[model samples]
Target: MQEKLTINYTNDLHSYFENWPKIAGYLKGNKQKLQDAGETCWLVDIGDHVDRSRPIAEAFRGKANISLLNEAGYDFATIGNNEGITLDYDDLYHLYDEAEFRVAVANLHTKTGKDPSWMEPSWVVETTGGVKVGMIGLTAPFPDFYNLIGWDVQDPMEILKQEIGPLRSSCDVVVLLSHLGIYADRDIAAAFPEIDVIIGGHTHHLLHEGEYVNQCLITTAGKQGFYMGEVEIIWDTEQECITGKHARAIPVADLEDDADTAEQVAVYSENAAKAMHRPAVVLPDPMPCGPYEDSRAMDLLTDYLRRWTKADLAFLNAGVLLDSFPAGAVSYMDIHRICPHPINPATVPLTGESLEQIVNAALQPDFVSFPLKGFGFRGKVIGKMIYSGLTFDITGTEAKPVAKNLKIHGRPLDPKKLYTTAMADTFTFGSLLPNIKQAEGKKYFMPEMLRDLLLEAFQEIEK
Candidate 1:
């Protein structure tokens, strides 16, 4: 007999729960309709559902996001970079503990456990008509961060090579829940033609109708909760094969919000607010912060970064601290509000020439004011470069300021001498700082974000 299995999926929500009510409403209502028609329907999430920038995700450590998934009736899911690298080992280990869905991530492995009980290498879903679909999940490989946090993130291609053949033999349809971005999805599609469908995220590319490559179908809903993805598989149960595949992203902005889900989200916000209300410190004096102007908070925070990493010199982007703190009891919530980026403190070993080059690049006005996105940055712009254990002289006035007379370790920069430069890992990716980005064997401090350091600074100041 012929059968149809409908897969409704979401990706890169990033804790943007505003449109979640409508998303949930669409899924819940559509799921009911498909079931009534004697077709199989399953709700799925592609990950990045729990972004720490959100109060609810931060307060509940992503348990709230999982709860929302449970309420939405999600059946299968995967992990994204945000879901995998943003949380500490303990948090990620327990993040899916209460999830109602099956978590299939083929490339994630933990050193702490023989296996993560909540994670499966692959999941086989059987439809009402007994059409078996094999699902494999993979996330972006960030070995440095993952290694620091005691996770052995395997290469996606290698894991797929090991898993696909076995999984394909056992199921009628093979699907991939991939958080490795669209480019990788295309590559994987070319490499693995047996994969009938690849649901992708991470780079946040929008796909209205879906992309067909190497006889494989690729789909994504982009970032936030703006759109939801749907896939229909026409299966021949008796022949045990897939006949057709179709996918599309449905916009949910104009849809009616599910009142119950909206109410629940509001409740989660209230509870998260209450949970984060506890005071971190009572400020004796207001600490100022901003992107363009000088910030004592940034200076102090840069000093703390050097201290935390024990690096010879340290620097940070002022924009990371979003707001100023008033002279009063500051709560953990306040800290998160002021600095919400999930960035890690990282150190890179570079020669004095490289350091000077990075510093010169960072000193450029256009460079500092660049509206950076991604790579763990959650701020408006790159902001002023704040430094610690380093000083420099300007060659000109505000007309066109030139950074010169750079000095560190109380001496002029040496071209050949290696220096450990401490900074946010945000600068280590893409083309932000070529010297830092190109540097090898860079050390990333995991789990501890810039906000955590800011919190620690305030707590210590209270002493």
Candidate 2:
């Protein structure tokens, strides 16, 4: 007789809770169908289920996400960058303390030469027909980010090599819950032929019908809980060796909502709304416009960054502040609404020539005014580039910079001198400016997001 196993998975949820009920509803219905037929089934998540971008996640530091996942019946899971490096040590330490599902991450260990008490490298589950299956989870190894947050992430390759060898002989099929993006997924498939399936996430690439690498079939459901993945394994019960595999991504948009799960979500949503309404600040009068120009709020934030980082200069995009200051009653909730991204303050060193190019590039008519999204930028538009510790004389109409002669700390720009400037990391990778891309010795400050800095800046303004 042939025994078939079904695995349903989601990846990169990032706290888009509005769609959670819908996805959970579908999973519940599917689980019942599989159970009634006496077939074996499992539900899993590849990682990134928690993100501070949402109020519920930000309030409880991902504890809410863990609870929600547990309520929805996640059987197994892994960690992604959002879950790995974004939270402080204590928060992460206790984040999964209450989780009911098995958390498998072979590559992660504690910084003090001990593993997290709740973490396991691998697990073996026996099927209804007594066939054993092995599973391992992996998170991305971004050491710099992890280090800042007081955690250490090991190399996935090294961990996989050590973990998979034992599973090869102990299990009929091996599955990998991978959060290392597509390149790493391909590499794992090539290097480890023993792994029968690779479920992936972290680049948000959608694989509708799955892809095969060597003997492994890989699948991903993309990001935002919009899709779910399925892996079907047909095993011969008697032989326990001969089998076939299939994987696919399933859309959940049209799926009916389960009433019970929907009720749970509504309760959580109401609680979150009430908690996020805490006060931030009280503005007696509205602050003037221009977050990038000479406006009060932008200038204040840029100056704060300069002083805080001790950089030679500081720059920021105006649109970082989303809404205008109303006449009165500015609260933490209001500030959060205006600046919701989980962006941190970063400083990069650049040469004087590179600085000129950066300034000039930022002043370009189309460049400064562009509406850019992604890369941790949740603002409306680029607006303008606000700078501190620098001065420039402009001569063009429409505020376009022309014949620019710039100075730093009352001195003219030196073509050969290196100056450390603080700026948002969003501009460091893209072609926003040559200087930003070519910056050297970049230092990123974590745990203290840009919004946190903004609140500090506002406090200073109030003082």
Candidate 3:
């Protein structure tokens, strides 16, 4: 006789709560139907459920996300880079304290070399019909940020190699909840034949019908809650092996909203509004700012970046400041509104030649106005480069500025000399600034975002 098991999964929700009600409703409905049919069904999330870009996530420190997941009935989950690196050590350590579901990221370990009480390497679930399913979780290893945040994220492949053997031996089928992106998922499927199903996220690629690699099935639901992924495995109980597998990405946009979840979201939003209303600093005057224009707010932020990183000089994009700060009392919400990116400050060693190239390239209209989506940037464009602890003469028209006499602390720039400069960590990746991306030495300051630095800068300016 053939028995079937259904696994419904979500990935990279990223705190996009708008579509969550539909997702909740759809999952709840389908889950109930499967349970009533006496079929084994599991709800899983592949990570990145919490993103600080949203006000609810920022104000509640991811606890609200946990609440939503709890209500949605997530059986198992992994960690994405956003959940691992965007939060502080204490925040992430206790993020799932109130979670009703189990988290199973095998690669994540504390600084003391111990796993959190909530984390398990793998979990085995037995269906009513005597089918044992083994589930393992893995996250992307971002060592630089993870190490700084008091966690050691071991290499995913190594962790998989160590954990998969035991799971394969003990269970009838093995499933991998991977937050390591689609490419890595495919690679893992090719490398490990023991893994029967791989549910993936992080790169936000949607697989409509799932892809078969070797004998393994790889599926993803894409980003946000636009689509929900479902995988069905047909087991031949008589033969004691899996017979077939099918996967689908179901669109939930047309699904009815769960009223209870909608109310919960509203309550969270109201609470977040009240929480973020607390005063952060008092400004003397409104700092007029724009993406292309020089502003007091951007200058102060750049200065703060240099001082905080202890770098000889600092450069920041004007667009990092989303809006001008008004005079009088500035609330934390105001700061969050102005600079909401979870970006960290980074100090990198750059040769004067590279620095000159970076500055010149930044001045170009095309580069400055380039709309960037990822790499920790929540802003719309790159904007003009703002500098602190350095000065350069502009020889071009007001519409465009050409760097002329570039100087560091009253001394002319030397092409051969290497200088330590502070800037947003966003430039360290991507081709936005090739000079910074290729920098040999880089030190990233985390846990404190640019908004945090702006708060400090505002307080100092007030004093």
Candidate 4:
């Protein structure tokens, strides 16, 4: 006798609800047909299902995402960076409180290194024919963010080393739910031969027919529910071993959606909208956020950030604010709609010479108008650089402006003197701001995003 084990999964949804109904329908429909045909079906989510950029995810703090997963009949789920570090400690700890599915995270724990009751290191499923399959879930680690939010995330590789041997010995087939990106999955496949299948996410690469590396099958269905991943294992029940492995990504854009699921999502969205409608502040005047032009809102935001972080100077792009708040009672929904990036504030110490270089570079049209991606920016472009406690003259041509007569706190900048600077944490990563990226003594403020700061700043108008 033989058994067909179906592992269906989704990853990096990131609160893209427009495509979720179809995905949910596909997963549920396939599960019913497979199980009705006497096959074993296991549904899983590879994480990042909860993104604050969406009103439903933000308003309920992820409980709604759990309800959707439960409705879709997910058997297991893992954490991505969005699920792991974006939320506060308590929120992330209790995120899956009502999740009917098992939340498997092998490398994350509390600050005291205690495992949450909802977290499982691995999952073991026994098929009807008695073939056992094991799953080990691992998420990408951002130790600094996790630490700031009162959780400790260990290295995924080290945790894998500890858990793989045990999981391998206990089950006929082994699966890895990796939220560590495509390149990391390839490396894991080559490093861990015992891993029979690796279903991945994070970098959001799609493998239509799956990629085989070192006798291990690696598969992923990009991001935002564009495709659904399927991995099948042919289990020989008589021998109690897995004889074959196959994987494929199914496109679901034009697929039929479950009416009930769609209705439920609409209901959730409606409720979230109502919840987010709570008043943030009453604005006596309109505060426009013009990315390419000077905006009082951006200026005030920079000033608030500098004061909040207690830095000598601060600066951030005008584009951080996506829209304007008209004169009236602005709701939390309005704030989130306008400034939805899950970005944090940070302070970096730099010498005046380095600061001058960064200012000049930032003034460049390419840098200011860059359609930046990653590092947690959820906006269209960088826009104009708005400064607080600093001013300078641009003397060169409009095409290539050169910053001169730079002053910090009403005095000329000293080349050898170091100053504490406040900025969005996104600048600390990559080469967009090389001097800031290379600067020392960088401190990040977590849990609260830039939107939170804007909310507080908007209240000042009421006063």
Candidate 5:
């Protein structure tokens, strides 16, 4: 006799709630169909379901996302970087307290050598016919941020080496839920042929039809709940082995929205608006922000970053502030709307010469206007570089400024002297700023995002 099991999954939702109702509807409908056909089915999420860019997520610290997952009947899930490092350690530790599903991620642990009660290294499920399936979860190892947040994200390959053997021995088939992106998924599949299926996310690559690498099927749905992934495994009961496997990312855009889920989202949005309505500051005058020109708001934020981190200097992009701070009462929601990125403040030690190189690179038209998507930046462009604790003499035309005679504290910048400089965490990773990325002695401030610092800056100004 042949028995089949179906797994439906979503990844990289990133708190895009508009399409979630359709996703819930599709998953529920398919799950019911599989059960009616006498097949076992499971609903899973690969990760990145909670992104604070959405006001609902920011207000609830991801609890609302957990509620949505519960209502959708998710059976298993793992953590993406957004869920792992964006919230404080305490918040993440309790983020899944009320989750109805099992959370599995083998590599995440607290700094003091303890795992959260809700975390599982792997899970085993048996169908009605006694076909056993084993599953394990893994996330990206961003040590810099994770360590600062009081969590240690061990190497995924190392964790797999320890867990896969035990999982393979216990079940007829093994599955991997990976939040480690596409390149790592390919590598894991090639290295572990015993694993029958790998569901992936983080890079947001959509594989309309699953790809097979070394007899391991790899699949991923595109981000934001527009598509849902499905995998079917055919098990032969008489032979006690698997006979077939199929996978695809099914489109959910055309599905009808679940009325219950839509109502839940509305409630969450209303609650979030209320939570974020608290007054943050009272601005005496409107502080206008611009992408290319020097602005009071950008300068104030840059100066605040330098002072808050106690660095010798600070630099930030004008684009970080998305909107102007209107006169009168400023609310937390206003600040969140203007600076929604989860980027933290970081200080890196660089020599005067390296700083000069960074300034020169920032002055280039292409560098200033580059549209960056990742590295925790949720802005349209890099924009003009705003500086604090330093002055530059511009000798070129307005279109292309050439920075010269750089001075620090009323003296010429010494090329060989090392200085600690502060900036947004975005520049510390990507090719946007090579000198800062390669700089030594980097110290990151966590549990407080740039928006938090902006609030403090405003408070100081009000006082």
Candidate 6:
């Protein structure tokens, strides 16, 4: 006799609740079909289901995501970088305290020596036909970011090595719910031949059909909820072993919304609108500026960020200000709406050599024009890197700097003097600013949104 089980999963939803009704409707319908046919099935999510981009997610701080997931009957899940690093310690600690399903991640540990009550390392579940399946979860290890949030993620492979041993020994088959993307998933499969399946996300690669690595099968449904992944496995009861496996990305774009969930979404949409209705900045007139050119408001902000950190200089992207403020009353909510990104200012110390590298890198068209989606950047593109305390000697068609003369309150560049620079955290790590990468001392300002500095800029400009 042969018994079969199916696992359905979604990942990287990122608070895209608009399409969620369709996803829920499709899942509910398919789950019923599977139940009616007497086939066993489970629904899971890899991670990144909560992002601050949506008003619901921002207002609830991830609890609302858990509520929606519970309503849809998710069986298992894991954490992604968004869930791991984006929230403060207490919020993330209790983010899923009320979850109805299992939340698994083997590598995370709280710095304060207390584990979240809702987290689990793994689980053992039995199918209707009595096949035992073991599942473990793992998240991406981003120490630099995670450490700031008071959480530490162990080496992914080390955790896997320790946890997979027990699951492999105890269960007929093993599965891993991975929020670590395709590269890590492939590594896991190659390292552990005992694991039968790997469901992946984070890099958001779409796998129409599952890929095979060593003795394991890997599948991903891409980002958002446009597609859900399905993995089917058959076990031979008589032989006490697995016989076959298959997986696919099932489209659910046109599916009808689940009636109850749809109503709930409508109510939430109204609430979200109310949440977005607060005033941000009171501009007396339209303070408009060009995309490529600098504005007084932007320059003021760059100056504020630099001076606030006592950095020698500052470089900020012009696109950080989403909309120009008309001169009047700006509220916290208005600031949020206008400059929605969660970016914060960071300061890094660099020598004259590294400073030149930073200026040269920011001058490149690619660095200025790159469209950045993640890293808490809710903006369109990086735009121009507005500078403070530095003047350029231009020699190119588009004001490209031939020589950058770094100064302090109008002094000449000193090659030996270490200069601190305040810039977006996005540029600090990537090649966008080569000097930033080479900088010796770096300090980060956290939990402070760029809009906060913008408000200060508004006040300074008004004065």
Question: What is each predicted model's overall lDDT from 0 to 1?
Answer: 0.89, 0.83, 0.91, 0.90, 0.91, 0.82
Worst-scoring 10-residue span by lDDT in model 4: 235-244
- Best-performing candidate as measured by lDDT: 5
Which ranges of candidate 5 are over 4 A from the true structure? Answer: 396-400
Per-residue CA lDDT of model 5 for 71-135, tens digit only, reads: 99999999999999999999999999999999989999998877788999898888867888999
1-463: candidate 3 lDDT, tens digit per residue: 9899999999999899999999998888888889999988889989999999889999999999999999988888888888999999989888988989989898989998766688887899897688999999999998988999899889999988888999999999999999999999999999999999999999989999999999999999888899989999999988999999999999988899999999999999999999999998999999988998899999889998899889989999998888877899999899988898889999999988888888888888888889988787888998989999888987787567689889998999999999999998999987888888888878888788998998999999899
Q: Which pairs clash in the backbone of model 4?
A: none
RMSD of each: 1.6, 2.4, 1.8, 1.6, 1.5, 2.2
Give one digit per residue, the lDDT tens place, for model 4 in 165-260: 999988878889999999999988988999999999998899999999988999999988989899998977678767888999999889998999
Q: Which ten residues in a row have the lowest lDDT in candidate 6?
A: 394-403
lDDT of 1 by residue, 119-234 (tens): 99897878898878899999999999998888999999999889899999998789999999999999999999889999999999999989999789999988898999999989
Off by over 4 Å in 1: 236-241, 396-400
Compose the digit string of candidate 6's lDDT tens values, residues 1-463.
9998989999999888888998888887788899899999899999999886667777778888898899998888998877887777888999999998899999999988889998889989999887889999999897766777788889989988888988888899999999998998998899899899999999889999999998799999988788889999999999999899999998877789898898887877677667766765466656765456688778878898888878778888887877776667766656666677767678888777777766776777777788877667778888877888887665555645545555656887777778877888877665655667766667777666577788887777666
Q: Is candidate 1 or candidate 6 better by lDDT?
A: 1
Give the 10-residue window scoring lowest on summed lDDT in candidate 2: 287-296
Using TM-score as the measure, name the better of candidate 1 and candidate 4: 1
Better of 5 and 6 by TM-score: 5
Candidate 3, clashing residue pairs?
A: none
- TM-score for candidate 2: 0.93
Q: Is candidate 1 or candidate 5 better by lDDT?
A: 5
**Backbone clashes, candidate 3:** 0
TM-score of every model versus the real structure: 0.97, 0.93, 0.96, 0.96, 0.97, 0.93
**78-197 in candidate 2: lDDT tens per residue?**
988777767878888777889999999888777877666778889899877777889999998977667777777889999888889998788888999999988899999999999999
